[model samples]
Target: MEVNIRHARAGVTIAVDGLAELRELEWHDGHVRIGAGLNLTEIERRLDGRIPLMAEWFPQFASRLIRNSATLGGNIGTASPIGDSPPTLLALDASLILASREGEREVALADFFRGYRQTELRDGELIRAVKIPLPLAPITGFYKYAKRRFDDISSVAVGIALELESDNVRRIRIGLGGVAATPIRALKAEEALAGKPWTKRNVREAARVMGQEGTPLSDHRASADYRAAMLEQALLKFFFEKSEVVRG
Candidate 1:
């Protein structure tokens, strides 16, 4: 029922006192399933960091020891503003299976998160599995912006997955975090990029609109002005990564 800071503090108090409590992880196509008891370290060794993206992103995370015990499912359930994977999974159009003693329900990533520290998940239910769509793009850009690169939660984090077709964005999904109450889609930005020439102009304008889409707070890590500026820049970077073509 606990891990990380609380577990580290409790030490002896937090133990599998009985033999009756133990479970294994579950996984399916392009996704993973697990009991609520799974932790981050077990996931790492289990996954062996084979998924290049997840592995690369791990180092930017706060703690290895915590990662050892911090379960992704738990984190998802917690739904913190700065939680890392929500934006990533949301951009990927991931689906989740929520289960209870009664039955199971599936919800889209976009709908799962309701607000800061809130999700659509009901009480007495646990996340059963995460279903991620296969990537349509060979190139993806995941950005986390904070004062320090390592172990710092971002003031703004952006995740975009794009599939380029004949120099245009044929398929696209955009996700943003730390700039809003919850990690959300930059749908306007996605529409702007789709089927159009993937040029810097379009990218800039789309990014501008994306920044305008949300009202971000001036937090300790960044200001509204700064976050807006970076969103624009994020658009441009994503564009270049997705396609070499330009709007000119």
Candidate 2:
């Protein structure tokens, strides 16, 4: 109250400590239902091996101290364009469950964000849990570029989820952050790669398309051109990594 009053702002703050539904972290069938209130450390520890993409990405969050107190739900609720988890979740085809006194509703993670820091969440409603479907694509990758490797925010980030049949791209989803008003799927890039041979040439072409999906801006962390270049390189890096895995 003192802080708010001194800062010339409303001092109201609601504590949702009693919301039991927002604390659940459980596996249903093959997928996992992660409560919004669950801290990052807990989410990281439990998701190891179970959801490899999440395991890899969670460590890239701020710092250990921040992770201890930061909640997965809080991150999603903030809806920052550069949020680490959103791109990864978008690639994984995740969904969020929202609850209100009326009932509960499911919203696709990709469709959850309406604009900068805005979401489909309604008044009097809260995020219940996040649903991560099981058996992620055989080839999954995440990459982010930041001024500082660890605690800093990303200048650009990419997440790739690809299912291959022989040497051809069976299915693919690419998620990008820090390049648009909201985290978005590079659907045009995905279309360029899908059903085509997973080759350097195809990957390169799709990467070109990837660079065109979002409207990036120049900021302190990086310039717009640099971010666009990184977007292309990120997808190519993931492609090469998957190729190495297949060869090995």
Candidate 3:
């Protein structure tokens, strides 16, 4: 519930944790709504079994101290290209609710980011909550490659969501981060894998397409080539690790 002071010249910094509306978390019949003010640790605890993918990736996030302080809303508000949560949220087809004095509006997480640290949030609008549709027997995976195993931003991060229908990929979504100006859905890669038989060959081909989905850049964390390679390998790794679940 603590907010950081980022502006050295700022005259005043007001605390909004007392705002009741922003601190509420609600569970519905077919979906869950998470308030913007809830910290990562709180969210993971509440959504543990209901949203297993979050638990799968939560350990790879920052240290416990940071998780206690960092809010999910703050992470999305920054709209950073390498944010760990955005890609996973996008893969789940999440929608963000933005509220203002005028009214509340919903935007798909896939369409949320406009550019590096940019989003569709307009003046006077603030993120109220994030809503995700429930998936029946979903198989999800998240992978992050960073300088350190923990507390470091990813050089490449991938999130995959799959619903299988008897060894065939009935539906699939792929999300990638740190390889472009914004976190992005690998639509072409998803298209390549959808409706295809769940096999190593099919996944490998789809991964090749995934490597072409983003325009990667060379940076201190990794070279452009390395990032792209990791992107492809991440897909393969996820599929292989979940092969039993995928086949079932």
Candidate 2's TM-score: 0.93
- Against the true structure, candidate 3 reaches a TM-score of 0.94
How accurate locally is residue 150 in candidate 3, as Cα lDDT from 0 to 100?
A: 92
Residue-level lDDT of model 1, residues 1-248, one tens digit each, is: 24655664543554331112223555556565534455666655676854444554566666787676666676677887677777776776777878788998989978888988789988777776666655334556677788887777788877777767777778888888877888788888888778986677877778878877566889778998898777777777766764542332
* Predicted structure with the largest TM-score when compared to the true one: 3
- Angstrom error of the Cα, residue 63, model 2: value is 0.6
Query: What is the TM-score of each predicted model, taking all chains together?
Result: 0.80, 0.93, 0.94
After best superposition, candidate 2 residue 123: deviation in angstroms? 0.5
lDDT of 3 by residue, 1-248 (tens): 12455534546766664477877888888778898888888888887767877787788888999898787788888898999988888888888999999999999999999998899999989999888887533899989999997998899888888888878899998888899999999999999988989899999999999988889999889999999999899999988899787556
lDDT of each: 0.70, 0.86, 0.86
lDDT of 1 at 26: 51
Q: Which 10 consecutive residues of model 1 have the lowest summed lDDT?
A: 14-23
Clashing pairs in 1: 26-33, 41-68, 199-247
Instruction: Order candidates by lDDT, high to low.
Output: 3, 2, 1
lDDT of 2 by residue, 216-243 (tens): 9999989999989999999888877778
Show the lowest summed lDDT stretch of 10 residues, model 2: 1-10
